[model samples]
Target: MKHISIIVPEGQSNLGTVACIVGAYEIFTRANDYWKEKGKKQLLTVELAGVSKNTDFHEGLLTVKPHTHISAIGKTHLILIPSLAHDYQTAVEGNQLLLDWMVKQYKEGAEIASMCSGAFMLASAGLLDGKKCSTHWSAADTFRTLFPKVNLQPDKLITDEKGIYTNGGGYSFLNLVLYLVEKYYDRQTAIFCSKIFQIEIDRQSQSAFIIFTGQKQHGDEMVQQAQAYIESNLHEKISVEELSSRFAVGRRNFDRRFIKATGNTPVEYLQRVKMEAAKKAFETTRKTINEVMYEVGYSDVKAFREVFRKITGMSPLEYRGKYNKEAA
Candidate 1:
């Protein structure tokens, strides 16, 4: 069985642990049917191996044994490092033993991945040199200041350079996991995992931070009113002219202002909101694609499928098949 090792940072923290447990659980559950179909002995196994937090013997969230199966550095197929506490002001004091182990593992061709602040640890390990990576926007400045060699793209949800993958923030970690599942298994498995986890698999292209940040800037009274209107009546026909009329602004002016504030056209923003709502129903409810289409304001099946594919890169039928297979 292929093993994915999630290396917890030196500090006695639970952030990475939380991400690994949830991500691994969803991955296995969704891939269960696929494994059975292929007659594989077992699906991928995830192991969380915590490293020492200095020599002071600081007890961590889980009880530490002197010897738990320390990963065969050269044998692990995938190694993941979730967000860690490292910044310009606070240097991440790492153990030499852990660094050497990681270097040996990388040399053996293990796919290394990081999430959120975890990029800092990977950067310090010399794995991110000359590589474009993403991290939590709040930590972007500090990471750049600390490691000038790593090209940081704070806007991306995640970046994959060769076998090394890094992503920004907590939610983006889910996007990274979905990407991995898609890479290792298939797009269908990733879709199944997203449904099992109640996540919007189609939202892989959208950055949660960017969406929320744009919403903060759109808190203007008129824009807020329009947003409220759209949220309350997502299924209703919402046109630029309708919003302009409701907000008492000229069509051109409202369109320009909304686009400027939200970084997407008014219709695009509305579609994003509607897509999120529809994705929730797709994951949680036993609705047919046509039913979901009409429920999400797309009366035409072709149009709905086209938009869903454009946003998520998967067809509605493929999505349903993945979930249905898992249910079996």
Candidate 2:
């Protein structure tokens, strides 16, 4: 049987962390049970392992006790890092021993998976350097600032590279679990579990769920000005050259600073801002696609549709149909 170790990180647990750990454990163990019920041998040994014996959360209102300490688990076929606390830096810093253990396990041929902000711990351990990863869209800027080497794809629902896997934010970790089930077991098994849990399977992108609030914490006054200008002039056709000139910076220099500060080029940032506004309009008002497009300063319907789909993984009509209740 393949032994799967789900690392219960040593920190206060948030709802996302608790849900991911419990959900993964339940799904995988249930999969094993289903396999056994079919007259087949049990295929997995799932256990909660940790650096410490137990971790408490919600001011000690809740506690998680692991089946074994990491020291006792000599080897594991897979290791899953659950979502971490919101204070990501502290979460990663507090779990040093656990992170080191994960590194050792990976080196010994164990595939590792991280859920949501758990990617922070993996990146902190240097396991995700130069590898493609996905995490909560809200953490994209911070992740990039902390681990610039990791290819962070906040729009993707899941990312698989080498033997490591990562999934996007929140309850979307269920999709990653399904992906793993299919990869480790079979398509039929995965479909069975998905139906049992009532989770939508094969969800490939979390882009539609992302709320783009612009990364302005990098302290670039000029970039902040540029972002403010873009947000303020959403109805105007603003050019990067015009922005650079308004900020009195060279085009190349402006582009470099903007990317460094916001993790997006000038044009990309503008599109995201515009799309966010469009999304809001669709969610709250009875506006037609063309009305919202013109409101956001897109003159070319084809260009607007292409950018919207690229950023949101859905075309304008599709996005509206999904989000707007009153749209005809």
Q: Which candidate leads the pack in lDDT?
A: 2
Model 2 lDDT tens row, 53-116:
7778777777888999999998899999999887999988888898888899899999999999
Name the TM-score of candidate 1: 0.56
TM-score per prediction, in order, is 0.56, 0.97
Worst-scoring 10-residue span by lDDT in model 1: 52-61
Which structure among the candidates has the greatest TM-score? 2
Q: Model 2: residues >4 Å from true position, as ranges? A: none
Per-residue lDDT of candidate 1, residues 1-328 (tens digit): 7867766555533445456545754565567666667676665776665554221222434543312334443478887776654432242565445556767888888888887777887888889999999888767656766777888777677789978998877667887888888887778778877777776664433333332222534346787788778888867867889889988999888988776455457887777677666666665677877777777777888877877665545677765664455422
What's the C-alpha lDDT at position 20 in model 1? 51
Worst 10 residues of 2 by lDDT: 9-18
